[model samples]
Target: MIPIDFKGKRLVLFGAGRVARLMFSRFPELNVVAFADNDSAKHGTFVGKVPVVQPEALRHLEYDLVVISTGWWESITAQLQALGVAPSRIVLPPKNMLAINNGEKPFSHAPTKALALEVLGCVADFSARHAIPIMLDFGTLLGAVRDGDLIPWDDDIDFSLNDHAYPLFVNHLADLKVALPKPAGCDLDMTVLEAEDLITGVAVTYRNAVGCNAIVPFEIGFMRRVIENGQSVTKGAGPSFIAPEVHFHNVGSITFLGKQFCTPDDALGYLSYVYGDWKTPRQDVTLAEYPMQESEYLETSRTLV
Candidate 1:
């Protein structure tokens, strides 16, 4: 979808986390009058030039609407109502409206175990052919580290590349796929997504035998910060890290689908750093996993062929 244009509309984003930053950049027409957050300490701070105010400030501020970007939108909406912003003035972002840099689609489905492995092999081979290294991330990492294979309940694949290697691969994704010595039998499509010259996300997608859209998604970012007990996660900073750079500083290999794939040295700690309940399997998954998003510093969107 084309990036939304909310020009001239004054907007007050409720949460100042990962999703909020995506909203901030998705709408170029939006005249973000102010940002509201419960974090009083951050009130005087700025999300770019726009100031973040205490939620209560919405009572007296003149704006068009209060955009609730947090997961707890119900509570935030009621809070905004009590703060005197009209109920109709509050809204949740349209479905799949979140900003994405990875080559991802608004919708995706899982693949068969064989297809999943093939995708992984394709990525590894492609990376090796070009001399670019890739790291397993998110559920894909969990599967390798936890079960040494893709999670049965999982539907896609994930990997990470340092900011530098990501674009190099994305720019040549299609050509590389076409050049694979013996490509996977599945139909393949790949893309590189960008906003304002920064790579956001990339995906190698294919249709499995079951007619499911299997995606091997990659995000470009650094694991920059630490989390606390999984209660508070840095939002809107862009996740797009399986672990911090230091953890990935030492890399090792794990047998995934009978092939050696790279993983972080402190695999358990890296898992803990991202998903706290790493030991227990949470089979229930959605596109909305990885709660934080990197702040979009600019609003330009482009695609590389």
Candidate 2:
């Protein structure tokens, strides 16, 4: 990704919709030139005081980059390209349609005991290499193993880095796979997160696809959030800690391989946020076991490479 030098550069964005508002609200530091949309009604409208313009008006100003901020990637990309915007100068937000189109769904399996341990190994290696802080977050905090069997859960291994360590992690991610998520099609999957410190960093999540008899894979992306003010903080504004909800009626069957897989309710709440609006059996446990011994600011020592 090219470094955004917004010092005096103009950022012309297309489609002043929800996604655009999300980006504009999150990153107010950038110099926004204006909004461009095909709808004639919005031509003279203003999005947060940034004037909306017709695409024809774009030629009047020299813009550093044209951002396709619309969620409808296919349509927006086509529109921007039709305006003769050089493909190289057109940038889409991370995890936009282009990025999703670039990769395939991961495969699913009964994760091994070694899986979580492998993440731990990666964290140890990453910490040694970077000499930075990384925390074993959320589900990964559940102890390494209990009672002779690996905790069989669909969750992915996750870890966090301070803003400073993020770039180094991204730059060397390929070489450090042993300390990071295993080989997937793309080298690194990136998402910008909101943090309490207002410091930006990437939380790495692993993915697996677990649909049998289906031609195209059904993907499950592992989810993780950063630790702030002694608890986990999500992508939402501030002071957000994951509060697990328990649903306990349907146990012993969580719908895996045509049979219900055992997913605890508290686990389900966390997974709900991770996977986005999933319902589980019922509430079993609220406070699931985590790996860290709570310390100052409730930080966990566990990490990923």
- Show the lowest summed lDDT stretch of 10 residues, model 2: 283-292
Cα displacement (Å) at residue 149, model 2: 17
Model 1 ranges with Cα > 4 A deviation: 1-111, 179-187, 207-242, 285-294, 297-304
Question: By summed lDDT, which 10 consecutive residues of candidate 1 come out lowest?
Answer: 217-226
What TM-score, computed on C-alpha atoms, does each candidate reach? Answer: 0.53, 0.34
| Each model's lDDT | 0.59, 0.45
Cα shift from native, residue 120, model 2 (Å): 20
lDDT of 1: 0.59
Candidate No. with top TM-score: 1
C-alpha positional error of residue 196 in candidate 1 after TM-score superposition, expressed in Å: 1.9
Report, for all candidates in order, the number of backbone clashes.
22, 22
What does candidate 1's lDDT look like per residue over 1-305, in tens digits? 32243346678888776677776775555678888888778889888889899997887788887777766665676787777778778876643445342223412433344445665776677666777666776778897888776666554566665544555766676766575333344445555555545555655554433453443332222121223343222222233223355665556667676666666667787788777888899744332454444333344343434
Residue 276, model 2, lDDT: 42
